[model samples]
Target: MTDTTAIDIPGYKQGTWVLDPAHSEVGFSVRHMMISKVRGAFGVKSATLVAPENPLETTVTAQVDATSLDTKDEGRDGHLRSADFFDVENHPTIDFVSTGVRIEGGDFLVDGDLTIRGVTKPVTFDFDFGGFGADPWGNYKAGATAKTVINREDFGLTWNAALETGGVLVGKDVTITLDLQGALQA
Candidate 1:
């Protein structure tokens, strides 16, 4: 549980904040071949934060364009968008809706439901605030980074190939990260 009274955001305000998609990113990294890691990012189709007087009471929702996945390899990217993985044609977007927020020690934990390929699971992202400020045009902005890890199988992403040496083509766990920036709405 979070002691909302203990949470003090310096420049916080109560209002709706819209994501600055141009400055925001939703990325993931997964273990490849039981060795190195492969990283990729998806386009943030939309996101919004409804901040109340108490930041802990804020609610967040975001949609990620799964079809926009890019890993710098065309073939791999195409495969990821196929039914074997994200199934972008059938499940075009990965969505998230916050359920709760809490403070643990010096960090914030955002609890939410993450849906992928029609499978929904609870996840907690360790959130780090990047402070609030104003841009050159005087639009109040806020920046943050949050991350969590999940098992690909849990999301129905069970496709894999076995190597001759006994290892699998892909690892089970995946790390999801969000680099977010939003502007406070008038």
Candidate 2:
């Protein structure tokens, strides 16, 4: 078992950190026809991190433009934006609000509610602190990588087609990974 004591992060500071969208990415992968994986990314609308002296008290809120989903295929992208999938016209954004942070098995975990297609569900992300540093321009920045998986049908993303060979066109589980870089607010 891993220790549950408070973690010590070197050079950690308490302040509001605004995500640099140009340096951040939200990507996902889902099984296609139970044979291969279809990977894509979404454009972040906004994300903010409120770090406290104690890392466990940190909070995060983020939004992703659902309409910005791109899978390198225009036809498939259009279908995902339709009512058959994300229904982006009605739910133009996917939102996430952190509730708490903790350490499990020596790994950081951020618990939060994820809303998609207007349906909300609790999800936990495996968080990794990528350390704090300053850029050549002297801007203090923080980086991290987080990931989680959820069932598509749990959030009203249930549209799928049965394959002739017996599987489904889309997998139920989707893996979401986030690479975030945030600049400290002055």
Candidate 3:
């Protein structure tokens, strides 16, 4: 990516920004056993944001290795990688490609298609701009947050167990959150 510092892109920096994985995180939480929530983070991934000449035409893409899911529990993470869940051997990556972007209520609404387990669905994330600045290392940096919720079943991640408590072991809904930090590249 080329460092773009001469122009300012709407809702982002002037040029392409490469995701700093060490400073960014992709995480999720879902109700478990109908009583509590299970939270986890995918610590491995790659993402990029391209700010076009027309700032409003910006685009973004991301890929998450399904096998990197870490719920902090060895057994559950192993299960999540099996055929009953992500089936990492078959569908190793979950991906997202933005289709459109617009400002709404002072925030950026990014509309995109998210793919998981070979299933794709339209989703929109509320994007929060964290502004652009210079890091201590003298590199220009940009930061933001994206958040959304999706139905696990919609993405073919419907595996679950029934609880005698009248609810399923895992909730259908999953909340995803992304904290993004990027460095301007040239």
Candidate 4:
């Protein structure tokens, strides 16, 4: 019998990692008036990740400022900050802490606790590993794209209005996207 180990893979090294916000983006989209979708991005302030050689044993934590929400429309953005929505004044930050990571068909399922508006819920995001490489500055960089969907109402953001057309003003489902880049920590 032959024992084989220590094969070098492109990525899968174990170490502490820090998110590079300048290269990362957290975005979301929600149904608007049942006729269109409104998209916005949250400036990911910071994040930390710890991964073993095996991607499955990874832990990730991130924080996003709720007040940094921007939808390209000031009026709508203001509404989202009020009591009817995120209530940025009360909940200044949104947080995520991964509980587990699983890989399926080359994709990853990152399960974590997501807190918004004082409500905490378990959510899972489908993530795609974008591989890893060394940067010009000698920093190892890893990239990933993640996506998930949740009901806004579940987070105590139930403010809504009835439209004359016989539907609610906004839909309940909100889709989120995360474009993340992490730099190897020394």
Q: What is residue 8's positional error in candidate 4, in angstroms?
A: 9.3
Tens-digit lDDT track of model 1 for 112-184: 9999999999999999889999999989999999999999999999999998888998999999999999999
Tell me, what's the RMSD of every candidate? 1.1, 1.3, 4.9, 4.1
Candidate 3 Cα deviation (angstroms), residue 31: 0.4
lDDT of 3 by residue, 27-90 (tens): 9999999889999988648888898676657789999878889999999999999999999999
Q: How do these models rank on TM-score, best leading?
A: 1, 2, 4, 3
- Which of candidates 1 and 3 is the stronger one according to lDDT? 1
Where does the lowest 10-residue lDDT sum fall in candidate 3? Answer: 1-10
Q: Give the TM-score of candidate 1.
A: 0.97
Tens-digit lDDT track for model 2 on 39-132? 9999999999998888888899999999999999999999999999999999999999999888877788999999999999999999888999
- Candidate 2's C-alpha runs over 4 A off are 1-5
Clashes of 2: 0
List lDDT for all candidates, in order: 0.93, 0.93, 0.86, 0.88
Error of 4 at 108 (Å): 1.2
lDDT of 4: 0.88
Model 4, span 10-86: residue lDDT tens = 67679999999999999999888899999998888789999777666679999998898999999999999888898
